[model samples]
Target: MTQPSQGVRRSYGVKAAPYGFLLPAAALFVLFFALPIGYAVWLSFHRIEVKGLGLGKGSRSEVWAGLENYTSALTDSELAHSALRILGYGAIVVPVMLGLALFFALLLDSERVRARSFARLAIFLPYAVPGVIAALLWGFLYLPDVSPFHYLLDALGLPQPDLMDGGPLYFSMANIAVWGGTGFNMIVIYTALRSLPNEVYEAAKLDGCSQLQIALRIKIPMVAPSLVLTFFFSIIATLQVFNEPTTLRPLTNGIPTTWSPLMKVYNDAFTGGNIYAASATAVVLALATFVLSFALLRLSNRRTTQGATR
Candidate 1:
């Protein structure tokens, strides 16, 4: 028989093999995620201390600023306006995108719908297009001289509104997001719909249920998991609205450097040369994202449990 010491050694080896394999991933998480996060948090609490013409040895120092950065960030009216602008943008993008996705998914799932393959491909084509290119294409389309919309409006003697200006810019940008995102979300929902057992639908039909009744009762309920997942991701994406606006910046005068929160952070860091404040804003944004995500997950879990019990 093996000695107890040898047996213990062998057991330890067996248990440790998995951890040894996981070591690389753990190291990467520490180096890339944990380390940078810790650094950012440390920086957020401090600012540059400049002395005497801001040049010489010991001239630049990082002094503790406590909650000064947070206070300033909170009180900045520009940031407040950006937040409200994003809120309005999100209000439009989230519902309209998800609604169109859900509608397209349902239509695709229905047996009577024709040319689904072609329609699906056409809709999903935008996902392959780069965000910059997509924005540029739409940017030109929104312009008076270049747009077919302008020609049609002029022919009809109707007023042609600039899509990239003022209040309409929200809708314009939201449209880009919806067009690019809907097909992907639709596919996710449609896959869930397809996975449902046929017997459930057959039973509903036998009970004198109409198509709409069957979908509302069975299909939508069954696909709630996918819907929740989509909604969560959509929320995150909406909150990080940067690329579309940035791309459109060169083509239009309306989008300021501080159009979105992320954009604001970028401008502060690069243009304003204020890395300390940028770090603070970035940390705040990350915290907000985590809180929102946690809240969404909890709400989804509660709803799921209540639904399951019923």
Candidate 2:
């Protein structure tokens, strides 16, 4: 074969360099994400068949199950209830968390705000705590005996509503999530607010606009993309909520073993010893998350495109 020119060799190297750099990430994705998802899907379509007493090696074998598992998962009452509960939970968490985050971010970005570093740290400290630990800490506070709120209520002779049961339980569960999640979302919004050009604010001020007007008109609209990002994350987190409810379950009668869909999946797989059913439930949850996330992204893109055209 004829020798390749130096330019051709350099061109080959240039073309291959990006792939070489991407190899590690691509390999990691395949090994961790893609492979595991594939296995879960494969397992979801298969079930164990037991012959006779199932005492021998050949007694039990894996067999194709088709849509049986999916049908069961879809029609499950527990899963349906859990889905409804999470819908209520997300309704509370998403708006409240994002609202508080946006509020705090606006405060932090203000000129007159004192002790900004301390404020930021205080707001963000909850996020640094592990979800399980945060749940435990909040769980302790929710108990009537140990909780200061209950103590104060008793001292004032007010009715002490149980935080662990009935309608109050929704707020109780949501509070832990809000307490832990608000800080991180606040930081995201704050970072975005900080990135905004100061000239816009200056122009708004020069036009005799007040702080509130500047915030509503300029700041919020400017940081909308960040809001959308935090909203997306909150949605995903709300869908996959497991640790908080699971950790708090021991402390409360309100929380069942299947309080969340993921909890149900865990109960089915390990506690119930039905991996195929769990796998099916998991695949369904994954698909729902993907659909919602993509839909949100598309909505966001549509809005952005409209804004650009305007």
The segments of candidate 1 whose C-alpha lies over 4 angstroms from its true place after superposition are 1-14
Q: How high a TM-score does candidate 2 get? A: 0.94
| Candidate 2 clash pair list | none
Name the runs in model 2 displaced over 4 angstroms. Answer: 1-15, 308-310
lDDT of 1 by residue, 1-310 (tens): 5699899999999999999999999999999999999998888899998999887999999899999898888888888888888999999989998898888888888989999999888877887888778888898899899999999999999999989889999999998998888888998999999999999999999999999998888899899999999999899998888989999988789999999999999999999999889888988888888899999999999989997899
What overall lDDT goes with each candidate model? 0.90, 0.95
Top candidate, metric TM-score: 2
**Per-prediction TM-score to the true structure, in the order listed:** 0.91, 0.94
- Per-residue CA lDDT of model 2 for 1-310, tens digit only, reads 3356877889999999999999999999999999999999999999999999999889999999999999999999999999999999999989999999999999999999999999999999999999999999999999998999999999999999998988888898899999999999999999999999989999999999999999999999899999999999999999999998898899987899998999999999999999999999999999999999999999999999999899
How many Å off is the CA of 135 in candidate 2?
A: 0.4
